[model samples]
Target chain A: MSDATEKEGRGVRAVETGLSLLGLFLDSDGPLSAADLALRSGLSKAQVHAYLVSLQRGNMVVRDPQTGRYAIGPFSLELGMSRLLTLDPQITASEEALKVARKLGQSISIAVWGRYGPVVTAVVQANDQLLNSAQPGTVYSVTGTATGRLFAALTNEAEAREIAKLQMAEVTPPRYVGACPPFDEIHEPLETVRRTGVSITYSFPQPGVTAISAPVYNFSDELELAVTMIGPAEEIDISLEGNHVAPLRALAATISRKLGFIGKASGA
Target chain B: MVKSPERQRGVQSVDMAIRLLEIVRKESQPMMLRDIAVSAGITSAQAHTYMSSLKKFGMIEQLGDAGRYALSDATLTFARHVIRNDATLNANINVARSLSAEIQEMVTVDCLVQEQPTVIFAVQGPRTPSLSLRPGTRSRIGNSAAARIFDAWSDTPEMNPNLSRIIRASGYAHAEGTPVPHLASLAAPVFREGALVASISVIGFPDAMAPEPERPVLRALLAAVSSLGGSSA
Candidate 1:
């Protein structure tokens, strides 16, 4: 419960009830009038009317004369995006990953180099004909999944080395070397990804699977997240057949630019 | 109809004035007093009083002619401010913009109102193909992708039983022909400090969006939206 809610407890049920009324108009096709709103919220006619009046006063609910209804005000959008900007990497990457999943018809996932090597915080799976579904909080073995390798490869040297050290310490028999492509070979894909600014893979994590991953740029040029496409081997062909690579690169690049990553030096 | 009865009682003046301002706002240039007054629903006599106050408040102003009022730049600034200061619904601009370009489909941000669902914001790319999407468009609550996501997130922390089921099972919501007919969408809730806050969604037409994987996409968006909610907040 919010501290305010906790503090008010039952005393402020009206505030909670009022917010519920406001929530209703947030997506109302048009502004809502106090009477109809009262009917919908099941609140007493007087209470709903009072809340709507108060809402208009606060600019949270707008009274549109043309339609004579109340809809959301500009303040609502501010609240939405303000929450959006806080976690730049996740929102940017997940939206892109959904595209990859939709196109590839396979599970696509996003990974970030967190304190625990590469963690798969988000996943989008193909609704049909799939294996290896992606789930949030599903941690990839540093050497475990393509999304993992992609992020592992993309990290700056120092972070990569540390993650590798962390991985080797955690995994039995050590993933520091052979299990994952040797740090030296990992660079080939990593550099290809960095230089070309896109990451691609085939049959990673398991046989008959191919995937593509890309970096997400935030309101700044800083590398915030990665988007990957995972799919069955045959379906992977469809992705390659289309000009998917170029669009993915362009898409990722555009997001980067929007995040204020305008420098050509980091355009890749 | 959406405005409360309390709002109807005496605030019509304030409401009409805001409407006149909006009428002036839609066009690139100033509008004549008749047009503004017609839209705002006040007599030219009553409008004169409202306009005078609006002008002083910097919400509207006279252009080349004394009777012509145009939206002032201050309105846009105020819009940006109102959008920012408002409670709870997050800005879907960059996310929607990026999704439109990236997905090559209409991207929308929606919220749940009165436990009903509808689209609050719709951003379409020049390339986005859509039959039913525009700014301020309306849709059924909890019926479409954007609606489902918004419904999921906007649920009070006390938690609606249905919403809790959707969030726990899928982490987001999905629907094929909800807010818009034949439009496909995958939507995810945005959470703030564990409370559902707003929603983000990607939309496409029937031909473009096959349903099987849409749920996963919703899940992915949910995780990311939560992150965005954290940092953006």
Candidate 2:
């Protein structure tokens, strides 16, 4: 190779290493110290600091002056929002959610698989009363809500199981009003969803609320988004074959087709 | 020629790559190579090198027959990571969601982003209010309760000479029927480690949302803020 090509390769490698450091923050639970990053990324402490200084300069990472720990920066968020503005799933789901909310007269939320877990992207409240718990940017638990369980059931299993395990670990018993379900226990519910193509949770994640959720798939026949319809528990029928589930499942199928999911119709 | 002090210290290529990415970020449309090159004041060949690295990482995408480039999926991944990893933001978002759920009123979390009071999170009330604010909505200085809360607690310049004094005394700011007709809002500051970090605001109709210091809505708002380690007094 020419000398110039070698130098260019080194430059690219530097950029790649710097970006990998930023990627670590995505997987981490919170802001990380330089030493923590160095340990996780398998780089020397001094090398990690050098890359952090570069990432910080680029506004890819920010160091809290008080704590000296690094977190992802706002510039990255602007870039993310720019990409999300054109995302096909969110746009289609938001429109479809509004329509479903209008037709059914219930609050609806559209959740897509964000980097962390299922993050709400759009919410359409019914006209009569408010269901304010689910808001855009709220990340649902993989094992907790209907929207979350739908995604957890439909997506890749190992990743879903891992996320479920972490969430179960974090859950307190008091929140469940009893012993929180064991990590292995979610398998049965998820398996049922895989067979049924819909997930339901009664008065969970919020009391007096029942949510029925279905999945939207992309061209690759992969789970792309989960559309959940929430209403008062006493009013919403919890049966898998009930009137409420039919419209929600139908809406998910319609959205899936719009997204080019040509596999056998969902919930089949 | 000597490099500027800012550019001289960090990795140069990473700096250039971020600059090119920012140029693409600022444009609404997918930009051609030459446009990005011109925007960054770099040669097309030089810009191509950086663009190649960014595209390799899925940070920028070249689209269609024209080869116009735009920010790509990696940016969203990074953005979500940033949003998720910020412990304080997540706690505040939880407070907004639960408070709105509890009070049956719209609640929002606002913070000063780049010196502008911006809505970082919002939860809609049960009863459909006249105005529904979305995340990323920027609040103006004079009329909004959030702006007033920031002025009262943070370094933002006070809009009213006595506004900060009154808000400081009351431990919250109230704006009624001004920013939008018939809308009333109560906003209280949230402090983490004694520094004003955000404002939690409840907004709704005037009849249901009277701006009283001892009202249940204001108490709930203050309680939520206090749970975040914010002192209302």
Candidate 3:
């Protein structure tokens, strides 16, 4: 290669190596050591160390003083939070979700169709007891959860079929086979949810938990977000005339209105 | 992509030092020189040279006399700079300034950072008392109103259950003579999507925050929190 080309190649290689080191944190359950990163990234320990020092200077990663292991730093969290704030749909939905959650005394979550499936972008728990119900950045299966099913129902036919195929591929043996119903069986329920603009499931995704999800539309009337209420099955009333459904739908409509949707669907 | 000649120019030792920092950051515990050297794929002598330079820059710090190394406050300082420029945080800072001016008391916006309640923004009123809290100050979670609000809203296992319950129920927390003697503070949680994003607080002498929850400063503080919480974008 030409001298300039070779220099360009080296520059790109350096950035690639640095990015690969950062990528290791994505799969790690906790902090990682240089040795751990070297093993995972196939970069020599010396190379990894060099990149890490640079990263630390930039505050992209931080090492615990007590433990030598390194993890994502405050700058990384700031970057993530900034991005989340910029997502108008998430911010709008979250505001409405917080109001509904406080009013109804039930946890609320906002999910958007993400690369893997329905990824929860924001969550507000009613109290300490429901702390573990859901959290931001959790990706749920499209066919197994209320938020996922709502997204599936709103998506195009080809994408919906792909999601169903992926969900079926994850099913195991005789027990799970029956547990995850056939695509044809779920299609009718999804159709009903699409017609009604809401989806409610009990003992799905997990037992002892109930979830109700309603679609939020943008100015163009396209489904952009799913507002969900999740809680313990015993405490969450999921019937049509129950306490949860009306308010849940109303909250969704409120969010849609905030997004500039002028549809006549009265959530009140 | 076309590379500028400047892109090719980089300090080799600086790169080596960064690599060491990354190694230390990745490790779960403080790392010994030998382990750091082995992980960095460098000799112990080479690693020692880079570690010494990193330590000089406060990028890495030695753990006691054990010869183990970990990151230092320099990383947090850099992180704080990023947070200081965040849009939502900046907007909240404006709110803090207005609230401080209205109440004639110190106002602050505290956010959870690395599981600790850290002051990200602060505005001192004209009549503010003698207190030294500034941006980046970490307050005690057990006793401070700002910290307690975060503890109450967070799901972290380290939170005090009883205090968290009270804060959750009341939507605010008040503390007297905590973090500092003779100081009183009231704080309200800012919720976004049902999660506690930050806490807005007003601080003053005990008398300024007296009469329990009926003080005007407290009302103004809650109003500021409400305004922040109601922001859709």
Ranking by lDDT: 2, 3, 1
lDDT for residue B177 in candidate 3, whole number 0-100: 87
Quote the lDDT for B145 in model 1: 61
Q: Which stretches of candidate 2 lie over 4 Å from their true place?
A: A1-10, A33-46, A64-69, A77-268, B1-8, B27-30, B61-68, B130-132, B154-158, B176-182
For each model in turn, which proportion of the native inter-chain contacts is also found? 0.03, 0.45, 0.02
Assess the local accuracy of residue A185 in candidate 3 as a C-alpha lDDT between 0 and 100.
Answer: 65
Give the alpha-carbon lDDT of every model.
0.54, 0.74, 0.68
lDDT of residue A157 for candidate 3: 50
What is the C-alpha lDDT profile of model 3 across B30-129, one tens digit per residue? 7899999898787776677666655654456776688688765344333433444344665676788788767878788888865668776666554556
lDDT of 1 by residue, B1-233 (tens): 35544545533334344455545545555677777667766555555655666666444557564657764323333333333333444345446555555555556665543343434456543344534343334455445665555444442533467765765566655667655576666666665666655567777665555544454444445545655654212
lDDT of 2 by residue, B66-143 (tens): 999988767756665665566777688777878877887778888776566777666555453546365556677566
Candidates, ranked, DockQ: 2, 1, 3
Tell me which residue pairs clash in candidate 2.
A130-B126
* Clashes in predicted model 1: 54
RMSD per prediction, one decimal? Answer: 20.6, 13.9, 22.5
Off by more than 4 A, model 1 = A1-96, A143-145, A171-179, A238-243, A250-268, B1-233
What DockQ do you compute for every candidate structure?
0.03, 0.21, 0.02
lDDT of 3 by residue, A1-268 (tens): 3553444445445654665576677555567898999999998887777677666665677766677777766655443332222225676688778888998888898887654567787888775565335678776666667877788787545555665567677734411211345556678779878787789888676778888999897532446779989888888888876799889999988776555454522231
- lDDT, residue A238, model 3: 83
Tell me model 2's lDDT, rounded to 2 decimals.
Answer: 0.74
